[model samples]
Target: MSEESGSLNTTAAVGEKINAISDGSQIISAGRAISALVSEYVQESYCYRWLTKEPDPDVIVIDLRETYAFGPFITLLDQLVPHIEDAWQHSRVGAAAERVFKRLVEDVFAPLSETRGYELAAAMLAPPEPPERRNATVDDSESTEDELS
Candidate 1:
């Protein structure tokens, strides 16, 4: 096999070994599910390969319901929004700001606040709805700006 293929196989084998050693029964928590969803959202888009693979409406509902199985992921989310917004805002400022933002997210926001961490992560996964448009096309020849105003 090629070197890269061999390395991937080795990694997979190691991961399997680790899983085998750990207890097979894992507690699926809302925070964990939300975190995973957020990760997938950030990694891809709303139209992720996993979503396409499992397009059944029932399955999607089941997955969403799993979020509530453990508890409301809301309280945790409420704590996370401000820190994340701050970090994101910082990144937009400059290179130094970006570094500071990354540090803040990694050290302060993520570590210090678990509930907020999951909340912020979940928000990132939310998909945008389609914008509403009028059925009729606007006429460029007419100026109705004053009338509309």
Candidate 2:
């Protein structure tokens, strides 16, 4: 098979794995999942170059955030957060999972934050804000303006 087809096959496999994890059909720990995702998906994408580039961190983060790969990874990370704790509690996989997660945080994310800035790393690692909270803030401001008038 051609290289492109192989890549596509790999991508599809990764996607299935991610979906399985999301649906709880697969019992892999978050760290393993994350490692697979980064190596198999993110590293092969356009963002990898910018992620490893020596230029400004914020610029790299910003550029990467706009790419197609960024959002899904962010979403996946958010989903994986709960699993990390659960995996850590299991004896069989706990130690290994923790080690992998820690390395991803330290080796991958920490360096990104240290070299680039916190924005991209934070965006990748942070849980997304709920829509209701955002809407409430906007509504509060609107109400305050009415009271002032």
Candidate 3:
């Protein structure tokens, strides 16, 4: 076996061992799911791999409240993630991701109080939607401009 493959096998074996030794054997969520969310679905407009793979819709819900993942996730939301409106319309998982994006604006980036952050937050929190609902489009097109004013 190649070094990386062998290492990953060793790691999985170690994880299995640890779980077996613990009081209750429970599978922990891995960063691979998060990575898939980032790489395949969130960042790739044409992809729905994240949604298809997460058996439970809630599996994909990112807790924006997580302080550790907050910075990196916010950076991705602010810079790289393209809002896939069609996916939002289709998948509940896609719709649920809105909370993370909204919190990115209202809580973290909004504190910075930059013009861009304010604009993004306004766009995110637009139309006085209730806490359960948020606008899913992050398109910077004129349609968004119309909604802003």
Candidate 4:
């Protein structure tokens, strides 16, 4: 098979089934198929440590059970975004999947940083803070002594 065909097969072979709760919400229940795909295609990816939350469209939660596939294939997301948007626009579940896709790309699939944790911390703190201003006036001018004087 051509490389393109192979990739298509790899993606198609992977599968997931999401269960929607009665409150019109969904969560992943089984992920072995997805895990197998990650093991096959995602180098250096590891099992998700916890359940991760998507920051938008608060209708669903991603079960980290299947996100380990992001370790290497995240670069594809730029291309995948169009597909994700198309899929999501068609279904709420797909919308949730798009968020999951983004999280995986951000947390695992992106290249490892050479900078140390301290470097990141320093960068965050590097921004200059606004200088503190002195408060000029107080309302304590009502002393009886001033009146007597």
Which prediction has the highest lDDT against the true structure?
Answer: 2
Using TM-score, rank the candidates from best to worst.
Answer: 2, 3, 1, 4
**How accurate locally, in lDDT, is each candidate?**
0.68, 0.81, 0.69, 0.60
Which candidate, 1 or 2, has the higher TM-score?
2
> Among all windows of ten consecutive residues in candidate 4, which has the lowest summed lDDT?
131-140
lDDT per residue as tens, model 4, 14-123: 53222224224432323555777776755543433223334467668675444777634555765798997887689989779889999887886564344477568768
Model 2: how large is the Cα RMSD against the reference?
Answer: 26.8
Query: Whose TM-score is greatest here?
Result: 2
Give me the displacement of residue 129 in model 3, in angstroms: 38
- Tens digits of per-residue lDDT for model 2, 30-138: 6678888878887778888778878776653365545697877887887998898776687668878778999899888777777655776667889888999999999
Candidate 1 stretches greater than 4 Å from native: 1-60, 63-71, 87-149
What is the lDDT, from 0 to 100, of the residue 50 in candidate 4?
27
- lDDT for 20 in candidate 2 is 78
Q: 1 or 2, which is superior by lDDT? A: 2
Could you tell me which residue pairs clash in candidate 3? Answer: none
**C-alpha positional error of residue 34 in candidate 1 after TM-score superposition, expressed in Å:** 41
Tens digits of lDDT, candidate 1, 1-149:
69999999999999999777564535535556789988977768655665667557765334443466544566566688888887767675656777888999999888666787677877888775434322222432234664676
TM-score of 1: 0.19
- Candidates 3 and 4 compared by TM-score, better number: 3
lDDT of 4 at 110: 60
